[model samples]
Target chain A: MRALVARGLPVDFTWCEGEARARALSEATGAVGRRLDLTDRAALQGFLRAVVDEGAPDVVLHCAAVSQARGLQDLTDDDWDRAVEVNGRSAFALCRALGPAMGARGGGDIVLVGALDRGQTLPLPVHFAATQGMLSAMTMALGKALGPVGVRVNMVALGPLGEGLSRALPASLVEDYRAFSALRRLGTAEEVARVLAWLALENTFMTGRVVTANGGI
Target chain B: MTGRLEGTRCLVTGGSRGLGRELCLAFAREGARVAFTFRRREADAEDTTLRLRALGCEPQCFQGDVADGAHAQAVVGALTRAWGGLDVLVNNAGVQHVVPLALLEEPDWDLMLNTCLKGPYLFSRAALRGMIRARKGTILNVGVFSSERIVEAPAHYAAAKAGLRGLTDALAREVGRHGVRVNMLSPGLLDVGLGRMLMPHRVEEYRAQAALGRTGTAEEVARMAVFLVSDENTFMTGARVTPDGGL
Candidate 1:
């Protein structure tokens, strides 16, 4: 959000539950922030409607993701459903809600933030990997469905943000993940955000594509 | 002020002219001890070295064909020995042919595959030896955007570039555990390199296709190369990045 604003794009952001942090970010950056539960279909619909009613945004970027890193033996069906609903399903809902209006208006862009799921030499939870795979497939499908109308759909697959993950995992483990990138470091949110903004604003012919921003991972 | 890559040791293949020349200068400007290989362009390589010296850095020049596995190894070996360890490797040596698939000869096929695909593989494998030992290094292979999508390059050229994607991914997975990373930089048609001399028509066509409606500058592409190999880009491996201004 800060990066997008810094790029001189007006950004309106949302969080699932972090109202305080979201509010502070919005206040600091002059971006509107809304606290909404995207996992709830009714709430998601309402939020999308409100956003559309206010005036359709040129770009709707979905970066909200939920991950539950549990062993296969310890995972539950509910956990799987939650992961899908949050990461994959919610994005589908958001696009469905936005696509038609954007199509009617003749064009817009939708970007989903995805993960470098399988091949990056990193450990991924079964649920998280499945959700990301779904998102990847959906991104392509959405691009094809929306392309004729000038709406572009794309995904930016990020590897690992070492500094952001360091708060939860050991710094050494974070470094271990960082070593997997050709850059030999973890990516910054700002860097990934810049790519997202580029796809939304600069990239015209790119659609149904997954751009990797994982320092080459 | 210190540059971002201060004290870093860097080497670029085919650094005598075109995008390779810009990459050599960019790395040198960033405070890296830069060296490069030029297959047969002694004058061009010497000119590049003189320019680097003017930038207050001594740049080393080598003559070798990166397509030759033995030559690739020798270049890496000499550089590793001289610098005590290799820090960054940019596989920028490549040849582009525009003939149709139906007309591409066997020799053209061989040349494309050897220079574009096998060159990066051999150079990366050779560089990985010292990098894995030091437990740190970055490798960027210069690739064409056609490798990712269908563009009107010859069958051999497209196939070779696509093969480079495979090489980058496999090498990244293989050496990543050793603290080495490998990636590819796939650029769209630029106004420099063989594009200027061989494909002026295609360059104009690509400019029309690009989102920005202009072909990219070599320096713009070089900036992305520098970032991908620098400390700032830590979490990207087996990744293919394009700085084509959106084609």
Candidate 2:
């Protein structure tokens, strides 16, 4: 939100699970914030209808995801279902609801945010990786599906970053990730957001590609 | 020719028919003790078992849903208890539906993700325990070659299979130090199983795009699956080997 606002683009609407956070983000970016639970089909549909009524935004950036660090032995069915619903299913729903409108209106850009663990040498969240995989492939399929209409679909795969989710990871693991990267440091939120902004706003020719911003990890 | 997988214990999911059946036969021919799981199709399971028996190796067939963790654990448990340990596991069970994204419902999405993506995760997770303990094992995830190519009305299938590629890469990295090699085999349009369902014109369309100018056979892909899980695949891990006739 900050990246787009900083770039002088008015982000019309934003959403999150918590109302307070949504309001906070609304204040931060001057975009309408709606408290949305993506797992609820009715609520998601309502949100989609509302967005469509307001006219489909020129760019749709799907970055919302729910994940937990559970090994195979510890992961339960509920965990899998939640991750798939929130991370995987919601993206599909967004594209399904919003893609045609974008295509009909002379094209738009849809940027999916994913992880940079294409072949991580370290142990990471397996369930999260699976959903990222789903997102990546969907990007390819949608890229081709919507490309003829001028819409571009792509994914920006980010490596270990210094803020947000990485902050929740173990300090030791963060250190290990830093050493693993060729740049020997974790990326900043600005750096990742810049990449997302670029793919969403600036890139013209690249589609169906995973533009990895992993510091050469 | 000497058997490449002599004395090896192998398990293949969804082995009662199609590419899964072909993989079972290939492993048995290479001199491995074969076990397989099928969701339904008792007659086909019986036939596959008989075929394996003709190759002079006893085969076991389990009936269960690959997506269920308990079923995956039970299958791996039985195989490990009976054979001491499992050496190779092929995550091959899958279900596909062709529907445009606009018309696709939640059930359609769940079915594909459960069978194609979650099945591999559950089975691989169950098998990894023994593999990690023994410091040796190979897991081959069967994916589709169309994951990279544009296909109509297969968004769910493409997502699930491509997700398997993600799992393959991450799992390989997680277990490579333990000597458990994990790789993905994405086969292109073959004249078997799912490919048989394609319209003739669609088949021709795919052929025209391929360098080989023809769809491949399941046998050709199964051979590559064998090589991937065999000793010959010593140095390769976290790789996606596509046998798509150069599409």
Candidate 3:
């Protein structure tokens, strides 16, 4: 983020989890932050417009979702709807609202973050599967539509990188996962964030695509 | 499993149908958390999801128009929030218009380029941040054989694919030293139903171009996607692998 800000790219570390967190981040980074729900359509539009009004964002780092790990049979309509709208609809709103301005300005970059399982499975993760999959397709489609207008689109397919989920799992379960990895270890959040910065700065020509950052494990 | 893509989280564009679907399944089976996309084809996405679930993967899906920028940003944001970061991104989503050169719709060119080239650019831009922060990542774009030989496909489709190939090289050149690997995969004459639909009559003709006796399969292409995206692919960037059965 400092690197980007140094390069004249406006960096707003958006924090929608809660008001306190958003405020803390805003103060800490001197960047705007938001505390809103992912499912709120109107608010999404307003947030984007606000972003543009402030400085017409060159890139949007999407880092939000509603998720569950239960089986398909356990998922309810609320779960399904929430995931789709939050994961899929919310992203579209950003593009629809902010993309044209970026295009008109001539060559703006917008990268979308896609999850690890749009193509994989995780204990019956049907809801996330649908939402993540569409997110990528949507990115590709927009790549086609926005390319002419001068907006670049891309996606990042992410893997697991934290310790909370691991700590929460049973002892044997961790080993079960470890056995399948090439490095037999978990990844970290910082690692993922580093990759994000490089793509933002260096890989300008590549658009409408995805990048993987899993450790050998 | 302990597959080549073990411990990886890969997102595959256009993953619900044709070669994209196979790439999804193969990634999951290989122990990567695979994320994939489907355009207007929810059933195909569902089918792929159901099968991927059986493989012990944690697959998820997102809905939006890839041709729209707002949606593209949202997708990336959601993934980061949910997974805390991204590992790999595969730009496999694309479209082809069968119209003759004179009959091509203006929007058709946009659609092809958006899905094939522009979308990858979006993902690359967004994912690069996370990858650079981590100091390691992989970017893979799916290319068509027509990228090199443009005359075979429709004008717009071929042109868009050609641009994508160029973008692949450009990305490799720009970010090879950042511990980020970017590459391209070009598959020819896949054996999927869509492959047949894309050119049913030319199946024999397609097979004849490659040294292999028959056309390719989604699984074969998926294998390449896994390699380019796996931990074994640390040093490769802006490289293109033509997985066209020696074509």
User: What total of clashing residue pairs does each candidate reach?
Assistant: 13, 0, 115
How much does candidate 2 score in TM-score? 0.55
CA lDDT, candidate 3, residue A161 = 49
RMSD of 2: 17.9
Best by TM-score: 1
User: Which structure is stronger by TM-score: 1 or 2?
Assistant: 1
RMSD (CA, angstroms), candidate 1: 6.0
Compose the digit string of candidate 3's lDDT tens values, residues B1-247: 2476786877777888888888888788788887776678888888889999899887878766666667667777777887777788888888855677788777887787787778888878877888888877788888887776533666777787789888876676566555677778777767764366665556767655443335677775676566567774443355555545333
Q: Rank the candidates by lDDT, best first.
A: 2, 1, 3
- Could you tell me the fnat of model 2? 0.00
Q: Candidates' lDDT values, in order?
A: 0.78, 0.79, 0.68
Candidate 2: the clashing residue pairs are none
Write model 2 residue lDDT over B156-190, tens digit each, in one string.
89999989988877787678767787877778788
Question: Which 10 consecutive residues of model 1 chain B have the lowest summed lDDT?
Answer: B207-216
lDDT of 3 at B160: 79
| TM-score of predicted structure 1, chain A | 0.92
